[model samples]
Target: PFDSYRDAASTAPGTLPSPAAVGDLLGEAGVGSDDTIVAYDDTHGVFAARFVLTALAYGHEDVKLLDGDFSSWRQEYETTDEVPPVEPTDYVINTLADDAPIVDREAVEAAIDSGGTTLLDTRNEEEYEQRHLPGAIRLDWMELVDEETRGVKSGDAVETLLADRGIPTDRETPMILYCNTSRRLSHTFVVLRSLGFTDVAVYEGSMTEWLDADGATEAAD
Candidate 1:
């Protein structure tokens, strides 16, 4: 279901969908603009966070995330793969949120040029070895997730982990997170925000767009 939702919501690979598309997505799901949205996924809430971030970008204020994931839910309750029928509504997009925590290619380039923002690469080691943005810190998004719970680690634990990597923990520290498609990076965005990282942002058009636009990259050492 999420796979279908994602495909329908996206305009292009590694890009956020238009606000109108998001409105349609919610409407088709029988969700209203002001309704409470609880998002979850099978993959340790990565895709759920992606949806939550997308909703937030469109000024949806009541979005919530399920702790853990569908597997976690199954462990506690009965499970079913049945798709429920729904009546679509007219969910209209009024206005996009101001100063949304998302960055484009040009903004990412400017951040790099300014040498002020921390660029974090949330991909696997093999992917990093193949190619990554110059000066991007390598931190697999899984590193912040608890394997047992399949949820984000505690805020204190995240702080310690980030400090171990020489990353700033101050709320004002500017950090830009990215993965190949920006989906995995959304989980990291939520985790960092929970720790009061006010200036953190996701590069929605991440490595995919970067490579397409001829942005330079470096292989791992």
Candidate 2:
């Protein structure tokens, strides 16, 4: 009801907690592996993505990203501006890499060095210009939600967007998305998936951890 993860979740809205804290939160909430945990955000899916990855890392299964997210929902649906009671349910913990869809800094560096993946940054132009991962492509997710374009274009439109950025939409091309964190990337992930991009995944820690790493390299366009 607060419409803010920070207000409701007792943590920074777009930040990931320690692994132990993640486990404790899920356990205390009685979430089970089979439970459907839907995470979303008002802006890009970055916050939702971080939450998803944390859930997965903490061994929670059946997690999903809410399409269009809170902004789109508010535009299309009437929402109450009050906090609602949460019903705790038992969720089983099940961590599976293939199903979870996450990568670390080392994996990201290796992917870039080996030309094994395309890194997509969903942050805004200013953020992208400030600093970014080496060999990363900037594709602001907010632009895709344009009112004129209606929040998602056809497959052809997606193709055009990728082509303009010199990116191929081939299924075999591994695409890894990131932002300050994964919240915005989550929405981007859903959009890419809807546009028929199958090999898309997200980097969990993103630029925050990347910049903090002892020997991380940055493209800094």
Cα displacement (angstroms), candidate 2, residue 84, comes to: 7.1
lDDT for 144 in candidate 1 is 90
TM-score, one value per model = 0.89, 0.70
Q: Which candidate is the best by lDDT?
A: 1
Model-by-model lDDT, in order?
Answer: 0.84, 0.67
Model 2 scores a C-alpha lDDT of 0.67
Quality of model 1 by C-alpha lDDT: 0.84
Off by over 4 Å in 2: 1-32, 35-41, 44-64, 69-87, 94-98, 148-150, 214-221
lDDT of 1 at 88: 99
Model 2: per-residue Cα lDDT over 1-221, one tens digit each = 11322212423234445454554466566665567888776644555755665665455657876655677788778988797656555434333435657677788888988996788999998888877788888898776665542345556767788889877778678899988756677667767766677788777667776777754545463
Relative to the true structure, candidate 1 has a C-alpha RMSD (angstroms) of 2.3
Question: How many Å off is the CA of 208 in candidate 2?
Answer: 1.7
lDDT of 2 at 178: 88
For model 2 the TM-score comes to 0.70
Worst 10 residues of 2 by lDDT: 1-10
